[model samples]
Target chain A: MVEIKNLTKRYGGNVALHGISFDIKDHEILGFLGPNGAGKSTTMNIIAGYLPSTSGTVTINGFDITEQAADAKRCIGYLPEIPPVYPDMRVEEYLTFCAGIKGIKRPDVKPQVESAMERLHITDMRRRLIRNLSKGYKQRVGFAQALLGNPKILILDEPTVGLDPAQVSEVRALIKELGKDHAVIFSSHILAEVSAVCERVVIITKGEIRAIDTIEHLERSMTANTLLNLTVEGEKDTALRILKDIRGIKEIKYLNAADGRVSCQLTLEDESVRNEIMSALMANGCNIAEMSMAKLDLEQVFLKLTAQKEKRSSLQDLLDETPDVSGEAPQDAANDTTE
Target chain B: MFALYKKELQAFFYSPFAYVLTALFMLIFSFGFITSIANMDSNTLKFSFPEFFYNNFFYFIFIIPLLTMRSFADERRGGTEVLLYSSPLSVTQIVLAKFLAIVTVFLFMIVLSLFFPIYAACTGKVIWSALICAYAGFFLWGLVCIALGMLLSSLTGNAIIAAIIGEIVMEGLLFLDQVAGSRLVDAYPHLNSVVTWFSMQRRFVYFSQGMFRLEDLVFFLSVTALVLCWNVLSIEKRRYSHA
Candidate 1:
């Protein structure tokens, strides 16, 4: 388990991460999502022991990152955004070096290097110098190096960036397979990628964590009132009245009523009320031409949550200018993210 | 520390860096050797291998920069520093490993150039003590250059800039002995004394004359230690820097 408690980082006057706290359990794959310069990399670097935190503490299993850095770092395999590699070294040689430095037994270096190359499918490139390899191959070599020590925690920053679509899916599948045993944490701007591989996500923006939850909950959280679109052949007022009369229908609005067919949008209290609304429309002499529920994907949720964070911060700034009238700051702004 | 040290050596040898530096040093030393031997009678100072070192140092000043240019600077530019920093290794280990690797390369280059003295030994009478002192003094001088170059490399991510700055600083250090004796420095006795003490040429003067002085050995070792410590400290500072 990894516990990050109120980790903060500051670069002189500019703060990169603010008191953000989160955790990853054993055998879990946590996705880190944030816009550019949103502290995603900062948090990962701190956890990977590449950078020191200004305040708070990070514990890997039971070892503090600052006091027991070597023990904690031994459990982590980090692939930075650029895929740190030496251009002059061959892939196998590089992995061997990594294995040695990671404290693998001298006799075990060769076998561990071979295993990592096999797992990353870079066995063909083992003898090739890293500089001669393509970008995709270089990235694979980097992954191979990280897997050498077989650490329990794998922290990859933008692992799939700059890869072709096929390689992206290949890496994603590999990460999912790895997730079954090791605790994996990877950050990416690609929302679908995160949704596909991650069991839980932490969305950060402007140096603060905006939301954290499972993939399923993030979509449900964004849909405050599920929007259902219906194309009906009926009079606008009669259709509105009938939909309004339904017990679970929250609101109804006609999108286009001038034509013979009227397209209307309805606010649904619950998705389970679809059958009741369909039956009510038929009984009221309304011909439902087509009906579909809007798909609020992770993309929309990410945008919505990030937008709300910005809007709330501005609101907070306005509130800061005035007296402490409410006697409390709005602390539950992200609570609705898990709705 | 051992793993990192081994990797640093491999990095130097696998590329053209190690071979090129050694070959360059040999070429310059050979040219100086032949010239000094031919002019043996013209100069009051005999064609001693130790005396030739002082003249050949001009070539080494340029060679040493190339030898140490990529120590830390290349790691930063190539982005491999991240791998080292995030590894289970400590910052001190990382710095010390690179330092030892470059110093080893330098020692090998000096040892290879021993062919000139060996050839002279076979041909005629040789000043054995002066030859040993020359080799020892040159090694110390090379180490000082390596430490200073390593320090400059750690200060920047650009290898070219590191090399340039390293050249300037080392050249300045080489001139400290002259600076101390200049008329301008006579105005400030304290500054002249301090500058002269850190002078590379001044400490090696006794060795150049085949005289072993404990104080001079202490000075060279102390300078190497101070610069190496600063190099380690500079990298440690990056641990707290903004990523």
Candidate 2:
């Protein structure tokens, strides 16, 4: 339902968004994953017609955002990174006003406002002044405002930021429920939240798209090795020697253990090694009580992709024999968890 | 537009700003009216409401800015501009609605000032037509100031800066006419006339003097329209640039 092409944005000498392109299918909840300044919010603003891209086009349901802003925006309900809320007005009045601005007719406004409140679970706080409401409530009010007019497209930027865990879960549930009928696109720095809620995920870094795929596919694509955890009730030295004898084994390391059981993690270079190791352990007469494989999760996949990109840039620096990329190493590593 | 207007109006009334402004206006009106009555001499029998209003338009110079400076400035500082920008409404509609809502509060003040005139007329006959023309002129002048202030507010998200810039612009326009009228150094006579046209007090002279010149009406209307239009365009550009 949304198509963005050649979207580029710059702030003076710094490029905020660099010729990115993507399509959000109808009724799909597309999670836009990026660290801060990755152009996630910029892309959301452009799609909502709140900002003009430097030299690109965004169309919603066949209407260009720039050329046909009203029509394009009519289909969108946007919640900016900062919740846009008027503190003086009560929650209900604010939502009603948003409904009017969204061009809901007088007769349809009440029901629409009620439904939005219901979805966000803010019906009780409807009578309280927004200034008096808590931050989580204000965020929900902003969400309710975005749901006005029942727009077919919802663009939410960091919708759950600053909310408590429960509130965050509530908003996530609402977004997931919204995905059932609308084309929902939300940006988030939290990798797990996006993976849990979005059907498809797009990872962006430095204004460029890094990868886009299903959660499992992204995990599988980025994982280079399969890690296995084994709890063998035997002497550590003997188990290590027997495991070393197995063919196709690439790497092995002692992990941890409880009581008399010994555990070690094994890395296989190929898929065939898993069955090889199983048979080898059985042949060694090792009492294997538990064996678990560790696959790359979304967080690990994200870090691996971003790290690979950073590694490529470092390789370029090494080829050029410069040390600036080396200097940026600690900073980029620090920014990952910070974002 | 109605949604924005309603929200702004409700914001004004719910906060203490409107009450403080109204109370301040009433104080000024009562003070000005009481002084005028006490100082009324028997020799000037033809004294009209127009002449009285001419002496009082400067109050709007102070009050109008105070009323309008926070309209858009507070919204930006408070992060409510996000809500407005994300909505389906056009910036033009939002700007106009905010402008009108501030004028609504100013209108209440103006109507309340009418009580002074009524009390003055109770003691002696006053020219009602001249009073109306002057009131229309004052309202239009206030409209221009509100548009200008709202435009200035959009230029900066800081409320203090918005208020300061609003005061500077409004006060600057007033002094432009004063400087132009002076014969100290006659370098640009035509430019002075144009500057005089912008002077809020000078523009009100014709209407307050019981003259309904189309030129004055068009001039005020166009100034209000241009400022409001620029406010809308600048806000939209800023929003788009940030997006």
RMSD of each: 7.1, 7.6
Backbone clashes in model 2, listed as residue pairs: A51-B240
- lDDT, candidate 1, A1-339, per-residue tens: 999999999998889988999999999999999888889898998999988899989999788988999999999999999989998888988888888789889988988888889988899888999999999999999998888788999999999998999999999999999999899999998788998999998888888877777876654544534556787888988888888888877767667876677777766677767788888989988888877664344565566556553433322232223222111222323211100
What are the Cα lDDT values of the candidates? Answer: 0.82, 0.78
Task: Report DockQ per prediction, comma-separated.
Answer: 0.76, 0.56
Instruction: Give the best candidate by lDDT.
Output: 1
In candidate 1, residue A118 scores what lDDT? 90
Q: Candidate 1: where are CA atoms >4 Å away?
A: A222-225, A228-294, A310-339, B42-45
Q: Specify the CAPRI tier of model 2.
A: medium
TM-scores, all models, native as reference: 0.86, 0.84
Cα lDDT tens digits, model 2, B50-136, are 666667656657777788778778888887776676666778888878888988998988888888778868988888888899889
